[model samples]
Target: MASRLAQLEGPIDTVYADIYNESGLRKETTLSKELGFKGKLIVHPAQIKIVNEVFTPSKSEVEQARKIIDAAHKAEKQGKGVVNLDGKMIDLPVIKQAEAILEYYNRLVINNQ
Candidate 1:
């Protein structure tokens, strides 16, 4: 199953309702996240909530992302845009990742309302 999953995973980042029902969608979302799928697809836009829930970073992740962007911004103000976070490099890319997640969540909230 792992081999087959890895094979299909890359090409099928977007899931299908035909392949999965509402309950299956929920399961697939969890499986996809475990398999490294960033998001899922839905025949109707209504499935966005499930996908959003599956893909949305956890509270801790959101906080870390926010911190990364904040620190990046501070570095930029100092004429820098890179540093080391827990021995890992923090740069514009990291900031962009954070911004992308925040934007995604914000969009979901706005559109789902």
Candidate 2:
């Protein structure tokens, strides 16, 4: 169904429907992230922390993003838009995603402060 909706000429975002069962909710959050869902819906207050932790970028992920951004900047300075980072292609979309992860991390830090 998600693939079908994606085939249409509009945006399609994933929304999780499961709202109960703590273990199940955790599993759903992991699956949702793997499936590229931006966020998930939760019914219980207890689920909030777990869901947030699951969705937020990890320390290693944030570090990797920073590295990718730095490498991309260096590549751009060399008149190249795409960069080779650890055998992976670092392009515009990948850079944008890294920027977004950093932005999200900054937001969380600000909120906590």
**Backbone clash count for every predicted candidate, in the order shown:** 1, 0
**Per-candidate TM-score against the hidden true structure:** 0.59, 0.77
Model 2 Cα displacement at 33 (Å)? 1.7
Candidate 1 overall lDDT versus native = 0.73
Q: Kindly list the per-residue Cα lDDT of model 2 for residues 7-80, writing each as its tens digit.
A: 53222234445555668777877887777665676666777887889878899999999999999989988999
lDDT of 1 at 53: 74
> What lDDT does candidate 1 reach at residue 28?
77
* C-alpha lDDT of all candidate models, in order: 0.73, 0.79
| Span of 10 residues, lowest total lDDT, candidate 1 | 3-12
Worst 10 residues of 2 by lDDT: 8-17
List candidate 1 stretches off by more than 4 Å.
1-27, 30-38, 43-50, 110-113
RMSD (CA, Å), each prediction? 6.6, 4.3
